[model samples]
Target: MFKAVLSDSNILKTSFDAISSIVDEVQMKADSDGLRLDALDRSHITFVHLEFKSALFDVYQCDEPLKINVDTEELMKVLKRAKSEDIVELTVDEGNFILTFENEARRTFKIRLIDIEYEAPSPPELEYPTEFEIPFSLLKDSIQDISIVSDKIALIVDADKLIASAEGEFGDAKIEYLHGEKITENAKSVFSLEKIKEMLKADKFSETAVLKLGNDMPLNLSLKMVSEEGELTFLLAPRIESEE
Candidate 1:
């Protein structure tokens, strides 16, 4: 048996809004500690991870560790109906994942679970030359600005600034923000602006995002709650530049 309750639904709603855009199905593990899920998109270009500590919930109980498998779209549909003030409860029984919203009225949704052989992938061990924190809004705006010029954006971190630049036949766009963190080395990588934008959909998850970058390496972006009770992380593969 497994059950968890929260006073706020926004966290769960926003997280899945971004996750469903990447993966169709996901397997979440619930234990005495908390609930967590790690999934790689079908194209294998994006890897997403989400976690919530047991302390974050108003009430959490689990007799034994359980795995909940369900379709992302199905879950998102139900979550969309949840209001900000609604109290959310999650549980699983037999072959269905259950969600209940309580407030003025009680609403219940049961989504059938899918059975499949599964193994969550371990996050790849990575060493980044530069890691810094920037506002989530800054990254979102930068990607939107870059999209106007090109589908691909190059992220560069120097001694004191983070720069996003893109080029196109029509025009080129560049945005730079001074990061007050000490950095010893410079690193740059190009990535799909669309992919990064998808991950940024969880803007409400956190005000600031921590970014990790390396020369021609994948991009690591992570968001954590103010109370440090939850975290959502993404690793996106980079685009290789070919010399003409």
Candidate 2:
């Protein structure tokens, strides 16, 4: 048996909104430690990792560790009805997950759990030579600006600066930020602008995002809540450009 309560519903809603676009279904693991989710996109090009510590919840109870597979879209639909100040409670029983939202009025929903054939794959460990931390708004705005002209963006990080640029048939746009201690070494990679935009949905939960990059390697973007209760991490495969 497992039951958890969170004081604010927005945290759960925002988290679901951030990942629903990337994954259709996910397995949520609940234990004494906390709740965790790890899922990869259909194309296997994007991976998302999320963790909610037990301390983050108002109430947390778990006699044993359990894994529950849930349809993310359906869960998001239920969470969408929750008010900002509502207290959200979750419980699992007989293969069904119950979600309750309490404010002036109480609303409860029971969603059936589905059987997921595949287990969550562990993310590969990699060393990134270049790392930097920047405001989430900066990355979001830069992607939006470049998307107007191109479908992909080139991210280049060196000893001095970190730059995002896009080149299209019509024109090119670039945004550069000078590095302090946030960046090191030199690395370059190209990624799908649309995918990155989707991942940025988590920006609402955090003020700054830490980015790690390597030449022709996957990009890792991480965000931690201001309250330091939860975190969202994403790994996106690079788009290899063909030589002319």
What would the per-residue lDDT of candidate 2 be over residues 1-244, giving only the tens digit for each residue? 7999998887788778889989999999999999999999999999999999999999999999999899999998998998888899999989798999998888999989999999887777889888879888998999998999999999999888889998889999999987676454689999999899889877667889989999999999998887778988999999999975
Q: Candidate 1: TM-score?
A: 0.98
Task: For residues 69-152, write the lDDT of model 1, one tens digit per residue.
Answer: 999999999999999999999999898999999999999999999975969777788998889999999899999999999999
Lowest lDDT 10-mer window, candidate 1? Answer: 115-124
Best by TM-score: 1
Model 1 has an lDDT value of 0.94
Please give the CA lDDT of all the candidate structures: 0.94, 0.90
RMSD of each: 0.7, 1.2
